[model samples]
Target: MRQLLKFELYKIYRQKSIYILFGVLMLIISLGLYMDRESEQANYLVYKQWEGEITADKLAYLDKEIIEIEKKMESGIETPQERLLYGISESFAYQLGNAHKHEKRIADLTAIINTDSTSYKERAAELEKNMLSKINMSKFYYDAGPAQIIDMIYTFGFVITAFLIIIGIAPILSNEYSSGMDQFLLSSKYGRSKAITSKIIASVIFTLSVITGWVALNTAVSVYTYGFHGWKAPLQSMFQHYFAPYPITLGEAYPIMISMHLLAALGFTLIVICVSAICKRGLLSLLVSGFIFGVPFAIDVVFEDLENIVWLNKLLKLSIYQCMKVKEQFVDFSTYNVFGFPVLYPVVTVLLSVITAIIFSYLTKWIMKRKQVTI
Candidate 1:
C-alpha cells in the first residue's frame, strides 16, 4: 500500500502542467505584491496609534478631528497628513456604524417575533440568535492584514486552487487507462481496493499542497506588507464584513475558512477523479471537470435573485462556488432548518463537503471495480 501510494504521488509529481500552473500562481502573487507596494503603509502606521479597545472618547476624538479636517479641506489648506487622518477616521467611523445596523437588524427580527406567525417567528428567532452572537464582539483594530488575507483566500486564491486541483487530479485515473495500465491494475487481486485508495490518497496530498502553497505565499506577502497587526481583531473591524455574524476573531475565522476550503477541495478532487475513471481519457476528463466546476459558478453569477427564493437559495448556496468561497457562509446570518433545529450555513457547508467526499470516494471505487478491458 505504501509503495503504491508513493508511485501514485510520483505520477502526479511528474505532471508538467502542475509545475506550470504553480509557476503561474507564483507569478500572480508577485505581480499583486508589486502593484500594492507601500500603498497601505500609511494606514498601518495610523491604525497602530489607535489600536486597542475602542472607547467613546476615541470615537468623539475621531468625529471632532474629521470635522476639523473637512473645514481645513474646504479652506484649501489641508495638508497631506490631515488628509490621511481624515481617511483613517472615516474608515473607523464607518466600521463602527455597523454596530448600529446590527442593532437595527436585531430589532427588526424582534418585531417579527412579536407578531403571531409561528413559521416566520421560528425563522426570525433563529436568525436573531445568529445575529446576537456578534453583538458585543465588534471592536476597532488595525485589521487590514488579516482582512486582506481572508478576502484573498475566499475570492481569488480559491479559484487558482480549484483549477490546480482539476488540472492535476483530473488525469490521475484517466492516464492509467490511456497508457493501457488499467488492465493489469483491475485484473490484480489488490488493484481494485488498494491501488484505488492509494490514488485517492495521493490526490488528497496534492490538493492540500496546492491549497497550502497559495495560502502561505499570499499570507506571507500580505503580512509583510500590512505588518500582521490584526489577528486578534473581531471580524467586524473590516468594512467588507462589518456585519458578519460570526462571533470569532479573524485569527479564529482564518483556520475555519481554510479547513472549509480544504474539505471543499477534497470533495472536488474525488469528483475529478471519478470523472477521470469514467471518461478514461485525460483531455476528456479535464473538460468534464472544468464543466462540472464552472457550471455552478456561472449559474450563481447569472441568477442573483435566486436568494429571494428560499429553496433555490439553499441549493445554490451549497453549490461548489459557495463551498470554495466560504466567506459567503459567514458574512451574513443564514441558517438551515434541519429536523426542527437551526444549523448555520458554515456548519451545513462543512457537513455537505464531507458527505460529498465520502459518497464520491465509494462511487469512484465502484466505477473502477466495474471497469472491463475493451478491444
Candidate 2:
C-alpha cells in the first residue's frame, strides 16, 4: 500500500497538470488581493469623508426608522404576506444602516423597493417598513470591504480545488487501462484486490494533497491581506441583505464554516474520483464531472427567480453548492430548522454531501468488481 501510494504521489508530481492548477489558484488569489486592496483604499476614502457627519446621524436615523416600523407592524393590520414582505424589506434596511456611507445604501434600498410594482403609497410604506426592520435586525456594522473580497477569493478556491482534484485523479485508473498497465497489474499475485485498494488509496492521497495545497494558499493570502482579527465574526453577519434570526459573530461562525468547507471539498473530490474510475477515460470523466458540478450552477443562474418552482429549488439546493457552502456567500438569507435544532446551513450541507459521496463510492466499488475488464 505504501509503495503504491508513493508511486501515485510520484505520478502526481510528474504531471504538469498539477503545477498548472496551482498556478491558476495562485493567480486567482493574487487578483482577489489586488481587488481587495483597491476596495480597501476606496472604503478608507469614504470613511474619512463621512467620519463624523454621516456616522452619528445615520445611526440615529436608523433607530427612528426601526421604532416607526415596529409601531406600524404592531398595529396588526397587515396580512401574513405583507408581514413577510415587511420582514424581507426590513432586513435589507438594517444592512443599510450598518453599511458605510459610501456603500450606496439609499440606491440599494430604493432598488429593492422598486423591484416589485405596487401603488406609490404601498411602495413608500414598504420601503419604510424594510428600512426599520433592517436597522433593528442588523447585529454588526463593521466594514468588510477587503475582507469580503478575500472571502470571495477563498470561495472560488473551493471550485478550483475540486476541479484540479478531478483533473489529477480522473486519469489515474483510466490512463492505466488506456496504456495497458492494468493487465500487467491485474496479472500479478495480489492484482485484483490489493491493487485496486492501492489505487483507491493513491487517488485519495492525491486528492487530499491538492485540497491541502489550495487551503494553505488561501490561508496565506487571507492572513497576509486581511489579517485575522475579525474571523470570529458570525459568518451570517457578513451577508448584506439577509439577517439570521439569532445573532452570530464571525468569531463564532468561521471555524465551523472552514470545517464544513473542507469536508465538502473532500466529498466532492471523492465523488469525482469514483466517477473517473467508472468511466475509465480521462476526457470523458472530466466532462461528466464538469457536468455533474456545473449543471446545478447553470440552473441556479437561469431559474433562481422562479421561486414558485419549489421542486426546482429543492433540486438545485442539492447541487455542489449545498455541499461546498458556496451559496452562503452569495445568498442573503437561508432558513435552518431540522428536528427542532437550529442547524447551520454549512454543517447540514457538508453532512449531506459526504453521505452521498460515501454511498456513490461504495456503489462504484461494487460495480467495478462485477464488471469484467476486456484487457
Candidate 3:
C-alpha cells in the first residue's frame, strides 16, 4: 500500500502538466501583486495626511469634527482642509457603526452555535445568558485599506486551485483504464482493495497540496503589499461597500475562507474522481466533470437577476462558484434556518460541500466494488 501510494505521488510529480499548472499559478500571483502594489500605497497617503490633524484616538473626536465641519458648511464658506476633514470623519463614523453592528451579529451567532439542546427551556436560558455576554467592540480605528481580498482569494486562488485539482485528480482512475493498467492491477494481489485505497489517499493529498499552495502564495503577497495592520479590524472597515454584519476581522475571515475553500475543493475533487472512476476515457470524465461544475456559473451569469426561477437560481449557489465567493457568502444577510437555527449563507456552502463529499465517497466505493476493465 505504501509503495503504491508513493508510485502515485511519483507519477503526479512526473506529469509535466502538473508542473505547468504550478508555474501558471505562480505567474498569476506575481502579476496580480505587481499591479496592485503601487496603487495600494495611495490609500495610506490620504490616511497619513489626517493622522496628525486629530489628536484623539476615540470615535467621539471624529463625531465632534463632523459637527464642526457642518457648522463651517452652514456659513457657505469652506476650505479644502475642512472638506477633507469631513470626508475622513464620515469614514470613521461609518466604521464605528459597522463595528457595533458586527459585535451584535457575533453575539447572535454565538448564541445560535452554543445551543445544542432541542428543548425550548434550555434554549431560552442560553438566549438570556447570550444577551448578558455581549462584547463591547468600539475602538476599531484602522486604515489598513482594502486587502484586495476578493481578487486574491477568488481570482488568483480559488479559480487556479480548482483548475489544477481537476487537471491533477480527474485522471486518478480513468487514466489507469485509458492506458490498460487497470486490468493488470485488478488481476494482481492487493490490487482491488489496497491499490484503489492508495489512489483515494493520493488524490486527497494532491488536492490539499494544490489548495494550500494557492492560498499561501496569495496570502503572503497580499499581507506583504498591504501589511498586517488592519487584520483585527472589521471587514467593513477594509471594504466600505461590504456591509455584511459578520462580526469578524480580516484576520478571522482569512482562516475561515481557507477552511471553507479547502472543504469545497475536496468536495469538487471527490466528485471528479467519482466521475473519473465511472467513465471509460479520461477526456470524457474531464468533460462531464467540467460541465457539471460549469453549468452553475453559466446560469449565474445568464440569469443572475432571475427572481422567478428561484430554484434554478439557487443552483448557482450550490457549486464551485459559491465556494469561490467565500467573502460574499460570509457577509450575505440571507438567513437559512434549519430546525430553528439561523444558519449563515457561507456555512450552508460548507455543509453542502461536506455532504457532497460523503455522498461521492459511497458512490466511488460502489463503483470500485463493481469494477471491470474491458479490453
Candidate 4:
C-alpha cells in the first residue's frame, strides 16, 4: 500500500496537468485581488471624508425625520410592527432620492470651488463628507463590509479551484486507455485493486491540495486588503441575503458556513473524478459530468417560480441545491422555510454527492474487472 501510494504521488507530480491547474488558480486570485483593491480603496477614501462632516446640524435634520415617523405611529392609525415596517421602507426610499441629490450637490460644490471659492479646503471636506454619507447609506442596503467582500473573493476563488479539479481529474482513467497503458496496469499481480486504489488516492490528494492552495491564497490576499477582524460573520446568512428582498446579518455563523463550503467542494470533486473513471474518455467524461451537475441547476432556474404547483415545487425543492444543504447559503431569497425546518442544503448536497461518488467508484472497479482492455 505504501509503495502504491508513493507511485501514485509520483505520477501526479510528473503530470503537467497539476502544474497547469496551479497556474490557473494563481492567475485568477491575482486578477480578483487587483480589482478588489481599487474598489475598496476608493470606498475607504469616501468613508474617511464623510466622518469629518457628521455634526450637530446633520443630527438635528435626521431627528426631524425620526420625530415625524414616531408621530405617525402614535396616532393609532397602524400597529407598531406595521409602523416600523413603513418607517424602514420610507428610509430606503429617502435614501434613493438622497443619492441623486448628493451627486448633484457634489458637482455644484466642485464648480463653485473651481470658480470663486477661497474656502476650498472646507468646501472639499464638506463634499467629501456628503459623498461618504451616501456610501454609508448604500452599505446598509448592500454588503460592502470587509467580511462580505472577503466572502465574495473566496467564492470566486473556489470556483476557479473547482474548474481546475474537474480538468485535472478528467483524464485520470481516460489517459490510460488513450495511451494503451490500461492493460499493463490491470494485468499486474496486484493490478486490479491496487492500481485502482492508487489512482483514487492520487486524485483525492490532488483535489485536496488544489483546494487548500486556492483557499490559502485567497485568505492571504483578503487579509492584506480588508483586515481579518470580521471572521465571525455568519457566512450562510451573508450569502443567502446577498441579493435578498430583506437583507439579514449572520455575523455569528461564519465557521459553519466555511465548513459547508469546503465539504461541498470536496464532494463535488470526488463525484467528478468518479464520473471521469466511469466514462474512460476525457471529453465524454467532462460532458457527462457537466450535464449531471448542470441539469439540476437548469431545472431550478426554469421552475423556480412554480412553487404554487405542489408537485413541481416539491420536485424543484428536492434538487441538488436542496440536497447539498448549502443552497440557502449560496442563493438569495426573502425567506426560507422548508417543511417547518430550516433547509440545510449544503450539508445534504455534500452527503448525497459523496454517497453517489462512492457508488460510482465501486461500479467503475467492477466494470473494469469484467471488461477486456482493447486500446
Q: Total clashing residue pairs per candidate?
A: 0, 13, 0, 14
Per residue, candidate 4 scores C-alpha lDDT tens digits across 72-103 of 77886665444544544454445444445555
Candidate 1 — worst ten consecutive residues by lDDT sum? Answer: 129-138
Native RMSD of candidate 3 (Å): 5.7
**Model 2: residues >4 Å from true position, as ranges?**
35-146, 153-155, 304-306, 329-347, 373-375
lDDT of 3: 0.68
* Predicted candidate 3 versus true structure: per-residue lDDT over 1-375, tens digit per residue: 889899988876677898797897698667856646555565555555554323355456667777878988999687766776677777666655665665665576567656646544344435433433332234444444335653466555777777777778777888988898879767758767777777778888998888777667766776677765656555555553255545566667767877888888888888888998898788888788888767775776687576588886566666666775565575445546567655567878888889988888778877887876555
What is the Cα-based TM-score of model 1? 0.91
Q: Is candidate 1 or candidate 2 better by lDDT?
A: 1
Q: Order the candidate numbers by lDDT, best to worst.
A: 1, 3, 2, 4
The TM-score values for the models, in the order shown, are 0.91, 0.67, 0.76, 0.59
Error of 3 at 61 (Å): 7.2
Output the lDDT of residue 343, model 4: 32
* Tens-digit lDDT track of model 2 for 1-375: 678668767876688987887797778666755546555444444333322222445566555655666677799665544444344345345455455431354455566666755454335434444543443223333335324533642457567766777777767667766787767655647655666667667766776676677667666665555454444333444554244322345544445456666667667766776786677667888888878777876776687584689888766666665566454532443434565434445456767768976876676566556656564
What C-alpha lDDT, on a 0 to 100 scale, does residue 273 get in candidate 4? 62
Global lDDT of each candidate: 0.81, 0.58, 0.68, 0.56
- Number of the candidate with higher TM-score, 3 or 4: 3
Q: Alpha carbon lDDT of residue 194, candidate 4?
A: 79
Estimate the Cα RMSD of every predicted model relative to the unseen true structure. 2.4, 12.5, 5.7, 17.5
